[model samples]
Target chain A: MENNRGNKYSIRQRILSSKLTFTILSIIMGLLVGAIVLLIAGFNPVQAYRIMIDGVFSRTKYISYAIIYATPLIITGLSVTFAFRTGLFNIGAEGQYIIGALVATLIGYFLELPLVIHVIVVFLFAAIAAGLWGGIAGFLKAKFGVHEVIATIMLNWIALYLNNYLVMRPFLRRPESESSYDILDSASITILEKWKYSETGREWLSAHPYIKDFLSAPANLGFIIAILLAILVWYILNRTTLGYELRAVGFNKDAAEYGGIKVEKSIITSMMIAGALAGSAGALQVMGVTKNVIMLPVMEGYGFDGIAVALIGGTTAIGNIFSGLLFGALQYGGPKIQPPLGAPSEVVDIMIGTIVLFIAIPKLFKIIMNARKRGEKNAK
Target chain B: MLNDIGFIIGTSLMYAAPLLFTALGGVISENSGVVNIGLEGMMTIGAFIGAAVGYYVGNPWIAFIAAGLAGGIFALLHAIASVTFHADQVVSGIAINFLGPGVALFISRLLFNGSTMTKSLSFSAKMPRPLNGLFRSNSFSDIIFNQYATVYLAFILVFVMWYTLYKTKLGLRIRAVGEHPASADTLGVSVTKIRYFGVILSGILAGFGGAAMSIAVVSNFRPTLISGQGFIALAAVIFGKWKPQGAMWACLLFGAAQGLTVYLGGAGVINISSQLLAMLPYVLTLVVLVGFVGKSVAPAASGEAYEKGE
Candidate 1:
């Protein structure tokens, strides 16, 4: 029998076909599995989901609040997507977000300028700082072929320290509070319309008829940036030469090289873009949600959640938005799930993790079996 | 001032000691072909179970042994899933890491009257003063000799790992399996068994590392208290270039960096933002990674499971 070694269908088609199928299947699979777990735990699986939906979208107000909640995640999700498209797993989004937030927050607090320039410079400063942070990892990988996973993870720890420093050191509160100085009001991204907050925020809770008092969320403008960036990222990834090179490299390095793409430059650029998105997300959170840049427990785990979002979305920015919305909803309404058996918000995390675990299986097993079969053939 | 240098080395070793043990374990596991990303989880479980057993049993030595066994079982889960079932190592490892604290916290709440942390049980596990006295002067002896026994074990493990990796046939098979497990299977090496051993060995060391934390360093276990130390050990492994001795040095450097962070941070000596100063070691780890970027290559099949045939 002839060996089909390496002559399998091209990655391009497999991606177009299999990835879509895998993604849909995984989502369904995750939901089903989670329902089963819920059922076994003696909870009404269907009701739990209803409550979940209710938590995120029982009213127009709720949905608005959910989007506000999803803003930073969408930003970070786009960040991860940008790098994934280029075959670089920029796991350091958390770090970049921290650095970006700290840098921009310092500018927000210390420097006085015209509101427009102040906002523009702060945002740009954040994006640039995060880009440089991620670029360092990219630079190392490009120059030395370091595994980006290891590099990015380490960077995350560094970010934790740097962020901690900003809150405690330069940006430390006048009274040593675990916060920075409130950004100048001119630079602060305030809610322009108080009525919208009444409609979409915790203020609306007073009007909630049944159990409304229990639900309150900070409805902010970061969600707008999240959605806009998601759309923008979709365009960049699907309709650009840069995106072509990136996907090409991710598909097959040798083939991408053959196609005349500069693999190294693409990786570095992709990482930079990933960092920028995360940084922007960080900046927006300070600008939109909180008036001041508080210490990390603010951005906590959102960056990591971006990985799950990208995976759940199968790495497409559009798909990420849907998944991001779904994730945002889960997070938004999670703590509100009524208990006897509501399970902590971690249940959603476990569910998300289980889905990714399922997806990682086929890829891992295929390579193992292929090598074994080759070994068996060689032995014979 | 001169004694401060010895004191720093002594203290750094004490701090790096746990990392060295864990990094050594990582070398064996990765070299033998299991990714063992669950080191963090394994270490945590070790800390939890060992501390629990120690608190209940009132014997620190038993806790030490129990920690190794506990660490091994957690790792065995990783081995069964990834080594036998051919699951993704990273994902599986993450599962274990997440499961570690979650399950431990759940049990701790139920058993310990809802106080998540075990009661304090501080007792020095340092080596005898006599051992250090013979090698160095009285001052050095007091610094090094009075350290935990784990320090000696870590030092011994480094040399032993080098010997096993180079001199022993089992080590050779382990290395071969990691690089090309399929070939090893053809030669009747039982890639699964080798991988299992590799992972379990990592667990044992990691467990001991955890035991070091509980018995020697903190002498108490808090929920999530290890706080990413296993990852630091992982970084140490990369810095050490996947070799036991190199990893030990890496651990020492990281430990010293951290020690200085604490020492200076405590004294308020470094006027930099305590936050920035605190972040220095983590940032240093990132810088160290750049040096490791291209220099270190993992075993070819480190994270890949071995299947018999299509």
Candidate 2:
């Protein structure tokens, strides 16, 4: 009996001490702040939240759509997560994403290969373009001592204008519209109907005729690719020597250098990899979702969104998958709930911002824990 | 030909004024060893408040005060998160950036019945122009002298920032804290107070900059009023090598890029796509960073959290 009691108490103690507690607390705090905002806006917070939750999970199609939405975020989250693990802030993810999309679009437009080969080629093109784009900042940091933040921020604007310029004129220009022409059908990812139904020769659809919504959803190979990459990242970070060196560089660059690691090389490699992840996000976005490059009136800002995902995920591969799903659900579900609540979907942005802000200040949680500990001691 | 050059110069000055204020704000905060990436957020809030208040109160001066106060208050959140809690400054700044637009748009929707822009106020306030008498005779002189009040104020602030950083006892303490806070603490100067002042002053200046966008340049505040000028200001701080005078020059160079874009694109003198023209300032920022060889040095303690007696 005493052992059972002690076990329960220790589990509670572990919960209090674990970093997950703060992560959950920050999320709750963010929700409560969001609730207050909703209240001020004259909506019932509980109902609104329920609507949001229900909107994301009401049907299998909703769930599939959520996954589709999560696909790009997961990649971008991993991009930021990978960079964080290497002790570098790659704020150029947006630029990298753009460059990747541009490269992927070019390859998709010009090339006419078999379906699988075309996809692989597009991915490779995106990764290399974005990798080089990200490496530019790393090179500047390594060679010229330029701060990555300044360099990346500049790159983002340049990429934005470049994307706009490319979309508007001689490169991928549509005569009547600002957006580019859709890529060849061979370059596009197969839809769910083709993936599942075609494989089973109509047997799968006969068994699940009610799943029309599921068949219509844009979920593609990209979602599976994102999941595989996440798991691969976890394995690499835990098992690989390269990952070990990267983490060592992140933990302490001078010490890593003393330990015979090539600090500059690691920085460049990590940034390049990070950029590839973000670029893949762009490639997936174009090939699987948008189908073409639409001229952006303003920045799409998926890169900044990646920052929130990474921070919420605790900058870990495993955490990224979960948090990426949450952010993705919020994003996909936000608009669905908007009409009912008469609230602009931007409340989700507020929630995300608030969560990140709370998570950033881990000291607040620590202070509260210390105060609680002192209170218990006095009682004892 | 000279008249056209003078016109471009005048437009450049007008465009540079807001950027000048924001860059000055960035310099102050960074010099105090705090990395403020939330200039965009602060400017957004300032633009909204300045326009909203100016419309409601019918006084641009009072609106300016409200705008500055709103920015300072928003910055306090950053100070508390970064200074008191010792959170990562970049994360805090990003939070500020996200929260600013969300909150601004929300409030804008509430007050304006779903419109993102505030109602235009009839009374527009500008800076005191002292050079009007000197340039009254010629068109070139008119182009130079005909400007909003903020243009002159921004130029004067260049001198003011330079004087404050180099001449005063407070400036000495600010520089000391930025360079080496631990050493400054040993000399009995409070690093916390200096940093707070630096950050708050930055908020105020950036607020004025945003206000200049809505009240002086444009008639009202829209969600996109400040756009990416705060970021341009940030680049200016880097391009200027973190010096007041240098930032002023950098702002002018960037402003000229913008001025050229507008003038050439509007006049159809530049045959290239407007998108390419729009790309000039951003591309120049990259060129300036890469091409400049002096190796700009940041404050030694910048981006580090200082704890007393640690």
Instruction: Give the clash count for each candidate.
Output: 6, 1
TM-score of each: 0.81, 0.93
Q: What tens-digit string does per-residue lDDT give for candidate 2 at B25-47? A: 99998899888888888888888
Best-fitting candidate, measured by lDDT? 2
CAPRI accuracy category, model 1 = acceptable
Off by over 4 Å in 1: A1-69, A112-121, A170-172, A189-216, A295-299, A322-353, A363-380, B113-116, B122-140, B269-296, B307-310
Per-residue lDDT of model 2, residues A31-63, tens digit only: 999899989889788898899889889887888
Q: Whose DockQ is greatest here?
A: 2
What C-alpha lDDT values do all the predictions have?
Answer: 0.74, 0.83
Every model's DockQ? 0.37, 0.63
Task: Classify candidate 2 by CAPRI docking class.
Answer: medium
How much does candidate 1 score in TM-score? 0.81
